[model samples]
Target chain A: MAAGNEEISLPASARRLLPPFAAAPFGPLLTLSLRSLARRRPGLFERLGEHSTARFLIDPTDLSFAFSVVPDGASAVVRVTGKSGSAPSDVVIRGPLLTLLGVLDGTLDGDAMFFHRAIAVTGKTEAVVALRNAIEDAELRPSDLLGLRGVLARLADAGILGGLSAARHFAADAPVAKAGQA
Target chain B: MSGRMELVCPAGTPATLRAAVLAGADAVYCGFRDETNARNFPGLNFSPQEMAEGIRFAHGNGSKALVAINTFARAENTDLWRKAADTAAVCGADAVIAADIAVLDHMANNHPRTRLHLSVQAAAATPEAISFYAQAFGVRRVVLPRVLSVQEIAVLNRAIDVETEAFVFGGLCVMMEGRCHLSSYATGKSPNLNGVCSPPEAVSYVEDAEGTTARLAGFTIDRFGAGEPAGYPTLCKGRFTAGDKTGYLFEDPVSLNAGSMIVALKSAGVTALKIEGRQRGKGYVTEVVRAFRRAVDAAESGGDPVEIDGILAGLSEGGRQTTGAYRKTWR
Candidate 1:
């Protein structure tokens, strides 16, 4: 398991290319979130194995957050976590934080929450919301970020984003959009 | 296409069951008035005696009765579902409609001779998912999700072995059935487990300073003027705000009327046309079933589909009807 406190120095070129926020808050946030997530290495691995099935997990460390997709019957786990502050050595997140992470990842939707109410946070609602927004902004595709490289191969014929953007656009406006726009 | 497509109808009570069968339903589906079925309303569904009698009555009239045991079974309380399966099998129903995997396994294991139809509550929208169920549990027919177009249905028909049943009229569900969690969020009970969504107990209507807002479990679903008809309070049809806009984000309050698409459905290889209003009165059931029976018979006899435009207009929800997902152009 990767330790959060492990010093990872970026290349000089990478540092220069990073946005100011990425260096200041975003970098630390990502590092902390990753390290915290890594602390739950076994659970994260378990979730990753079941990504195609229905099980989900959310991990929120002190400075960052993460989620894992565990396959239903598989032995392996796949995890994806991100944060907004300095990376820590070890971290733990509440169950609610884990569920919210699944929602932002698009693995879960509003209707799912509306129906199940699977995740509920107790302490800091705004922090969870912020974490959700940051993860959405990151736009990390599960196939790419997670070690589901073979899953991406199956979907390769469908194109890079697999018509996600077009579908979103269509869902937002659809047939009524043209008439409404006029 | 071939013969007249079967008009499969819903009957919440024995009265409605008899009415639908006599009015022209080739088949009627009902459930035990318990949590085992989706329409677990207070007065709806059948008693075991009613179910046995309903089956005998339908059979005597050359019609079939299907028992719906469609609710998802809890992990520990599998006995309730097993008992429902046993009762349906004992009642001599033509088929038992089920959704839960464990329940399906139970039926297959216990009553291997009994026919199983996949309930719409399974939400098996894709061919792969549907095939998975059919292969696993010997599901003879699948009541497909309402999301597919006629073309999609045709394509699926070519791939799967089982017959397909589809909604041709009555209430419209905006999201996938069985998978919906909206009702559970507002109220603790859900369709998957409790077999009721937006239950009457949790629904309330109040005329406030703004308007008459229909609420489900205290959350506003829709608001109507004094003159406008207030629709049922379901979580999906509720008016809510998302980024400042406040309106129906899921679907407008409307019933489905596929009267004009009888020919298209026949061409698409749909074996059964389902009418969905178990909570309605016998008159509504008789009228709708009779109209559809006439339409289907006419179309089968190489005649044009019968038109009951004015009669049906009065029965529609809010006096509005949509073709729903049948016509791809709606998407």
Candidate 2:
């Protein structure tokens, strides 16, 4: 398990209910996902243009661990760590796990999320914008990360669907942010 | 009796166009992918094929599409602007909004049948200037610049022959329409020239204990305290020090929410009420258009003004609302 995960105000009933799964290493799956996406859309990272060299810290606030992704086309790897893991990423995108997933999968608007304060970002706005543009164009779904058709894909998909209610589960316990609250 | 104001909305993409139509816009305006139209962000505009499809969608849903061929034509690339105008005409755009004299001349001489609306980028604030466009090019309507007060617009409307459109909501530029040099000075790309003020590539936010610092092209624009609503540091909204005091020297980082002035604007003989932010997402487009739809309807039916100052609170940059120059004459 990652150390020093930022403590959000989720209720005891919803917090860390997926103890075993939360402990499961997500780096390999994320790495696989990025590789699959790069393979399917060759120009995905190239669209990042000058921002290709920047490292991104993707923080899923509902989860215990965060991820650092160094996007370099097919060779990209995702490192799962705590919020305080890195010194300086080109950008830091923090939000509920499912919403972040939704943004990546093009199911949600990152701008709307940012506007609603559902997402908090710091660091290079250009890199964040580039990532958003690249992700929107690539049109990758969460299940696309697996690239499998058998039982493993089914299991991953089930987990992905279950993650939605679980995200709301965490959110329901947290204090509601006010209108235009940052 | 006051005539019902036409609701003009912005659509950056085809999905947004459909959203605006479904939500309640009488018209939606968009741009081509090239710089011939403004709001030329990467992956944000429509192509010729997409424009044709979007226009068809708007028309099918009882909405009109206004193609923005608004950017001034480069001396060497005048044909590019003409081609965009040609594509807009070919696609059967309800109107082509243009600013440059060459473009207006091209539209008048070449596509004589197509309707012409003067873009706010033209900054034709006077009856004389507006009369020149109306008489010379047969421009049917002119989008008034944001610099005018509601009273000034009321007075100007009676003197001009053409219809007038006024901005009701969304982003505000303190500059004279798109005539901004600060963006060019900082990033070397003017909204007038390149269609992007504080171009995304030139923007960055750095977070330390001092809080978030918004920068434009490596120059510090502003800093926000922890948990403060951070705003994009456009040159106009950035706080600066003048004469030993630090503050928003030009204007504060607040969005224009002119809902209260809807009835007043209608009384001022405004033909259309516009919502800005073509580069906004479908969700943004949907919510704002719907809220203003009710507001506009209320103004028509003699109901409440919809008190929309707080409706757009979450979506607005800096999370603050203002009546803007519509009420207060900053000049």
Candidate 3:
């Protein structure tokens, strides 16, 4: 077991709950993130062809990559290499992409993947807008494994999602509770 | 034996651009409305057409216009940045202020005649890094990061061939520019790449049964009581619990007020003094530029440092100020 695992375990009720799509270890999230990437691959290829100088250096397994886009938000170059070796071929991506590959590949967290740095960019500023629009437009919602309304709804039902709420309530109500007793 | 230091001023609009020029700014820096500049806030910065007009107006008054295209360029979007650079060149800008290495490389290669001023966003705080940019891209000037003291500035000025610009007054950024990840941790955007830090979009205020708290990207950064003045929610200035103490760990919400340090800065051999705040209004631009202009003029005339206390008190952040790293204070 990991160092902290001994301190915590799934409650009997929580254990009976089905894992969400992304919470089922890495398998489903990886597949979903990859599927999202594959869906956008055609657009990526078209964007890559538009820029002569743009290139991407990605470590899909490690989630580190460098990419360059053309001056116009039309084409890009992406290289995803292994830790020790060069990339296979400088893959191309279209302008303004969310680039789910990093999150799927476990190189980046969900937040970082959605945020700016996960998709390291160099070149034009409009490409950022385009990329943001594309990703947001995709609305890559995390899968609802048990067909719950949403990720939050499922997590709330599972009883594991309220740690922050408990922590916040404890921090806020501790003093109030003490005063009430006094 | 120090050469006459240049005094750079900010101009948010064309009128302020004229005000800065008429007030005796050696050069005026402004940015286009898009993400090309660090001050990407709405209602601030000039449109491309306005930038052309501002550049013309400044040049007409015998002052130079330095276009700030300092934000880090996004990958696969090089065209916008390239066009920004090209536009500045065509608009007769005296120089292009940039922070990214790739942007510098592009400018140096494509527009060889256009002067390049390295923005503070590069965080080239060390002599070696400044020297490296100078050697690599022939950068004419480097806007030194806000982490250096007067003595350090003198030492750095000696080591590098490029001219150095140091902030004299206005907002203070505690973290090393171009190096901080705190903003990215909270907001998806960062100043280095996105030209914004602790962006307004990611901020929220929650007044619960306990107290009023400011949250950034769902993390409670600061909490305020009813009487205390609530400040803009920046990650560094926010109150947080680190260990037993729940207070500002990084820095207080204070603007940098360096009006009293003009003599030290002049003696330190800084080539230019930059005033930060491009989001400020025209009145702010007028007052600050006027005050600094008087101080610089007084210093040049061998007069006592001009008193500019009343002029800029209204424009300070949280109505509080500090000399920042210029004075070595433990707190």
TM-score of each: 0.63, 0.83, 0.62
Tell me each candidate's i-RMS in Å. Answer: 22.8, 7.3, 19.2
Backbone clash count for every predicted candidate, in the order shown? 23, 0, 25
lDDT of each: 0.66, 0.78, 0.62
Stronger candidate by lDDT (1 vs 2): 2
Q: What tens-digit string does per-residue lDDT give for candidate 2 at B1-331?
A: 2678999999887767888899999999999977887787765677798899999999998999999989899898788899999999999999999999898999999999999999999999999999999989999999989988999998999998899999988888867886868989999987777777788878876668877677899888887776566555687888877788898867877778888899999988999999998866666777889999999999999986687776677667667778888897556
For each prediction in turn, the share of the native Cα contacts (below 8 Å between chains A and B) that it retains comes to: 0.00, 0.23, 0.00
DockQ, candidate no. 1: 0.01
Best prediction by lDDT: 2
- Residue A165, candidate 1: C-alpha displacement in angstroms: 58
Ranking by lDDT: 2, 1, 3
Clashes of 3: 25
Among incorrect, acceptable, medium and high, the docking class of model 2 is acceptable
> Where in model 1 is the C-alpha error above 4 Å?
A1-182, B1-3, B208-211, B241-244
Q: Could you tell me the lDDT of residue A89 within candidate 1?
A: 14
Q: What RMSD does model 1 have?
A: 23.5
